[model samples]
Target chain A: SQQGEEDPQALSIQEGENATMNCSYKTSINNLQWYRQNSGRGLVHLILIRSNEREKHSGRLRVTLDTSKKSSSLLITASRAADTASYFCATPRGKLIFGQGTTLQVKP
Target chain B: EPEVTQTPSHQVTQMGQEVILRCVPISNHLYFYWYRQILGQKVEFLVSFYNNEISEKSEIFDDQFSVERPDGSNFTLKIRSTKLEDSAMYFCASSEDSPNGYTFGSGTRLTVV
Candidate 1:
């Protein structure tokens, strides 16, 4: 299926703390993308890291890809209460296969 | 920033009835996809469309399911006969290419009664 599995199914942290979530997949991928979904809403694209790139960053989000390990991680620095959402990693084959996702709660 | 737009934010239909979820992907995007998420469950892929035809689909996209790009900008998903399990939030997304980031619509909550 090439679906990514995310670690720490749920996480809770105080505002201003960093939150890190990891994802592992079974097959080779063209690129890995991170998406955040607010409760009952649609997914919002976070970042995309190509297989050849080891790391990429967008604003407060940093994503690292380890092709050898077949895993990736997303780090959000100084998370705000608004950061509370479910995060998913997707591997786009013909269609995008998403992970189960990590639910984050950033308390203010 | 352009966004994917979905109509009829919520729809309630009786079992065995047909339902058509509509979306208008961002203009100039080539890849369009449909995904669904049941309450408290993971998002699942259903189908992908490109160049006016389906490029790929999941097992869940059965014969009862179909997609169409009736015009230059609108995409639609039709379920011939919806079941109770068909109740979910249907999301439409589009990407410029296979490796690009996707823009998703707010979704249409389909309630099959």
Candidate 2:
């Protein structure tokens, strides 16, 4: 079974708008993580929400996890051109598995 | 902030040849991992290392693939014999623990011709 799968494969929005991306997974998990990758660069750690936690926030990023629904979402408020990147959700079961990221393009 | 550093941002190798990718993870991290991304594809886990040995590996990590943390600081992945399908952007990552956030290197793009 595919572990982490994200929706809205691509998204484009103007600056100052809010961008939301969702990720779903199969099987149970202890926690889920989100990452952002600039083109041809490495992934940067974003936020991590545990199975018991419903919401988490850091700066302009907000993450929510629904263990019962087996899904999670990332919300970036007031997006900027610098936020243009691919976002992936990950789950670890010994080894971390990533979803087919959501490519977000925030136009300036 | 500390970073995971990978060498040779890009490499071109002939098919059937051996290739070794190197990474220096964060000094205090206890867990290290390797992942690869084919062009326009999702990231795939190759292997995870901890306690000086492999903790887990993906099906993609076949007999031709091997990993080592030879000198405690340098973690390496070696492909015994490369294939055309082996071309991808390989990333090295590390975390203080499995449940914590990981720091990833910029990745090494391997091209098998």
Candidate 3:
């Protein structure tokens, strides 16, 4: 499968703590995107990093990409209870293939 | 911000029956895609439509599957004969430019009994 693989299938942290998720894909990509999904809901786009860039930040979220390694990581700083959700990294080939996802639980 | 909308948020159907999931993608977007996630599995790409034609489709989108714009505002996915294994949350997404970002709908939960 050309799908990306995410590490630490799950993570738990206290409120105000930071949470990080990583993704590795086997093939070259045009861009990588991160999404967050609450239980039984659709995914919300978080951030997108191009092949040329190494890192990007949006609000409390930060994303980093390493093209040479074909891996990417997402960081949510000062995570809140509301940030508890499954996060997925999508790497684009002909179509976007998602990782198994990392389920993050923020304890309040 | 404009969001994609899907009708019949949840649908229950019998095996072998035809099921159609409808999506109204964000207006002005040029690319549309369909994806499905099983109860505990990763989201799998089903197909992508552009320029009134299927730009790319995964093997999962076999002969049993078909897509159509139907009218100016709606996009539809038709499963000719549904199977029990087809039960999953189906998501419809649209993006102004691809490999960039995407906006997704709440999703239609398909339950094939």
Candidate 4:
């Protein structure tokens, strides 16, 4: 199915704390994409990590891919209240298949 | 930065009414797609268009669902009839290549009253 399933469907953290979300796909994939959605808003592109890459970083966002376990994780460091949003991981297999996202609450 | 633009951020329609959602994808992108997310649910694929015709569609995109690139620039999704369950946020996306390089629009919130 190539469907990505995310764990810890919801998370709560302090403003300065870091938040991590994990995703596991049923089958192998070429790449994994991360997206964020503010409450009742659009999804924004966060990052894309290829299967060959073990780890990648963009600003405060860091993403790691472990092909052996078919899992991926996104770490947001020093989160702010603005970071409160839902995060999703997706895989492309003819079409983009998304996971049930993780709703992150970064309390100020 | 270029973006996929969708019109009417929110629309309210009655049951059995027809509605056409519009989108303008990034100029250079060749592949276009439509996806929907019901409240608190996973995003679901509706259809994909390329070279001016539908390349793929999901079961949810039944006969009632239609997509068109009437002009070189405008893309539209038309639903023959709206149902209560059809209420969701419809997002338009464009990609330079299939399954990658996608940019999404703000999305249209469709409410079936």
Whole-model lDDT values for every prediction: 0.94, 0.94, 0.93, 0.93
Cα miss at B59, model 4 (Å)? 1.1
- TM-score of each candidate structure, all chains considered together: 0.97, 0.97, 0.97, 0.98
What's candidate 4's DockQ score? 0.82
Q: Point out where model 1 deviates above 4 Å.
A: none
Residue A86 lDDT (model 2): 98
Q: Model 4: residues >4 Å from true position, as ranges? A: none
Model 3 over residues A1-108: C-alpha lDDT tens digits?
756788889999999999999999988788899999999999999999999999999999999999999899999999999999999999877568899999999999
TM-score of decoy 1: 0.97
- Which residue pairs does candidate 4 place in steric collision? none
TM-score of 2: 0.97
User: What DockQ does model 2 achieve?
Assistant: 0.82
Give a tens-digit lDDT track for model 4, residues A1-99: 648889889999999999999999988889999999999888899999999999999999999999999999999999999999999999987678999
The DockQ of each candidate is 0.80, 0.82, 0.81, 0.82
After superposition, which runs of candidate 3 have C-alpha atoms over 4 Å from their true positions? none
Give the per-residue lDDT digits (tens) of candidate 2, residues B21-56. 999999999999999999999999999998998988
Model 1, A1-108: lDDT tens digits are: 557889889999999999999999999988999999999998999998999999999999999999999999999999999999999999988777888999999999
lDDT of 1: 0.94
